[model samples]
Target: MKDFIKFLRLDSLCGQLVAIAVLSLAALQCVNYYAVYSIQQSYASEFLSVGHDYLASVCQALAHMSAAEREDYLASLDRSRGALAKPFRFRAAEAPEWETETDYYKSVLAREAVTEILTRAGIPPRDVRARVLYGDSPEASEPHFAGYVFPMMQMLVQDGGGSWLELVQPLSVTDRRLIWRQRIFIMAESLICFALVIIFIVRAMLPLKRLGESVERFGANPETASPLPERGNYEVREVARSFNKMLARVQRNLTERDNMLEAMGHDLRTPLARVQLRLDSIEPPELREKFAANIEEIRSIVEQGLELARSLRTSEKAVPMDAAAFAASVADDMAANGGAVTFAEAADCGEPPLVAARPTCLRRAVENLACNALKYAGGAELSVERRGESVIIRVEDRGPGIPPELLEKVFEPYFRVEGSRSRGTGGTGLGLTIARNMVLLNNGFLTLENREGGGLRALITLPALKTAKIGEIRS
Candidate 1:
């Protein structure tokens, strides 16, 4: 049921269009069926009325004719019957089967109509009888129309000689097969129209879909978001034009901000360098050491502030890389630097877990997590694995885990846990913030959770590249 709902995607425009089309078709079919049924009822009623009048006239004409001329007159009338009209077969008999089975004919309307017409013509109602017979009856030899049985009217009138005049005529009614064929044709036509409408609507809305995808891509990595084509309807084209203009403005603003930060860093570092040189000439060694420590802290803060700004607006182009190999490389580099970081290889899968990432930015984010573990926990373990369409990179430590409430607060810039994690550990409080921004820039997610027993787990989830795309990249 969930899969079916997902497939419908009623949240989207295309799904709404399909739903509307189906409902319209259903309503139209219902109207069509009612119209066909009403028309059949009206036509059948009119035919029966005309049939009663014609039968009565024929009986009256036969009453006036001599016994010898009656047969000749019937023959002439049969010959004059139109091709489209049903022929009335007349014969003189003692007692027909229809007369004996009077109770079997259950059509009260037809019998009453025949009796009324005969009585008005001066013939006694007792001398005239009418019955309806279906084509399937044993006494009826008439063939069916398109495999459908129709009722035939059988009438009997007693002449002056007391001989019974038997008349059998087919009821004028619409064929069931023809009505079904018309319905089938209408349904086919409606389906064709529905398909054409859906195609037109989808094509018209295609530009909107592309625009939404472009916006999402720009949010993930502005550098990789290309300008959308200014085609389709006028409104769509205008929206694309506006989006392109916005992208240009944002890029310009980022560039100007970077230039301003670079200038400020250069100007501040010059004065800080001069201060370091002057600190060496201080009288007391302890006072000089304290001054030097403060200056170094200031310098670290300045550099980290610049690094945080850079992480938000990376110009690095993302490329597909093996996540397992990348995690291992980071771990090996940290181990070489005497950080006590261990690399755990993932289980051998048929294909390497590949993710699209900016190498420098992603590496810095991973390194920040590892460094935090090494500072507090004294050691860190790095591992990578593929789970479904995502590649997960985890940094685990056996440190005293953070408080549940403060776990999310640590990600906020300049916010630090004061209990387990103190200011003495020395962080500008922007490490997690910077890491999260960098991961988001690569369209990945980073989350911190306390491990079982005692420890903290830093997990990064990146979208895995398809095997086909990996082959294209390698080629």
Candidate 2:
């Protein structure tokens, strides 16, 4: 129950509104039902005129009958119906005690109605008594109808020998059930309508949902993002219009930024060449090499900055390609270039898995992880394995693993681990960041963790391919 409630997203305005509406309707329905019921049970105040007149007439007719005629008429009436009618002394009767407010009302009203009838008939009222009770056969008792209070009338007389007359009003069990059935049917109809309204409301908000998706897509790939439609209610339409305007402005800014970075990098090459020539003229050999190395670092930084800037633009489009085969090729290329990289076969499938990814970007991310493994662990093993609908490419090495605290920090741009910031590391600290960004743009994830055997492992899992465009890949 707690889990169910925890999962309920009442933070959403739509969910909160629907919950309030349904609860309010249900509370109103319950109150309406109870109000009607309380009023029905309080029927004693309404003065049941039909029952009062019938009881009076029966008493007047009985006063005119002879003893034998009264007995014969009563016998005939007993055979036809269960309405018991006779006169009895007031002392020889069982009095019913009223337990509830409704019962007390019935008792008081029955005594008053009976006394008035007898006094008008020239009979002393003090010698007469009346009581109201409910008639239900013990054999036919049921939980549902046990509390069904049906009114019954009983009167006693003490003119001669004690006797009594009882009149029980007939009740229709089916008719009582029909009243509840009608109420239930109405409630069911109301709930059905409410559900339909909820469904329509959700469908009507679909355009807003689509707009959210478009915004996220643009954030991921601003260069290649398509414009969202100006469809939906007024608020959604306004939001879409504003979002399109913002998207266009951002794209223009990014294009300008990329162009400026390229120009700056291009212009720095000449100054770097001049500095390298100037450093060659130093007198001390060691100092000259050190200055040349510093100049080299500057050049490397400029080239890496340009590469990182270019990678930030996610213009590459994904297509269906062999993911495993692609990783194997990267390993083969690194091996050819004097790097110790080799591919491993998956235990499941012999064939490389086909996935939707940009070949250049995907290869670059894997190549970066492989280079990290070779540099830190001295050698690297690459494996592409299928894990259900996704494919994971594992890059493992047998070198000193990163500190648990600084594992995530290694992926930050321009961040270097302690004692690894020199030219020996062969990076300006943008490799992992660029690789992770490329993986993310292709709808994949990249993570690093310490392998079990004193080494680091990098995993890049790509989502399974479903559909792809048949045209040439975007770059």
* Candidate that would win on lDDT: 1
Query: RMSD in angstroms, all models?
Result: 6.4, 6.5
> Which stretches of candidate 1 lie above 4 Å from their native place?
1-14, 35-176, 190-203, 210-232, 471-475
Tens digits of per-residue lDDT, candidate 2, 341-432, equal: 99997776643476888888888888888888888778999988877678888999988888889889888888877664434777789888
What are the per-residue Cα lDDT tens digits for candidate 1 across 1-475? 6643443477887678777887887788778777867777677667667766876777788778898788787666655653335444555656554443456543456667767887888975546667777767765663422333356666676666677766666564556687788679778877887788667767777888889889998876564467999889999999999999998887778768767876787688989999999997996999999999899988988887787768777678788898888999999998998899998988887768899889998999999999999989999999998998899999999999899998888988788888657767787798998898788877887999999999999999999998678667556
Error of 1 at 226 (Å): 5.2
Q: Count the backbone clashes (under 3 Å) in each candidate.
A: 0, 6
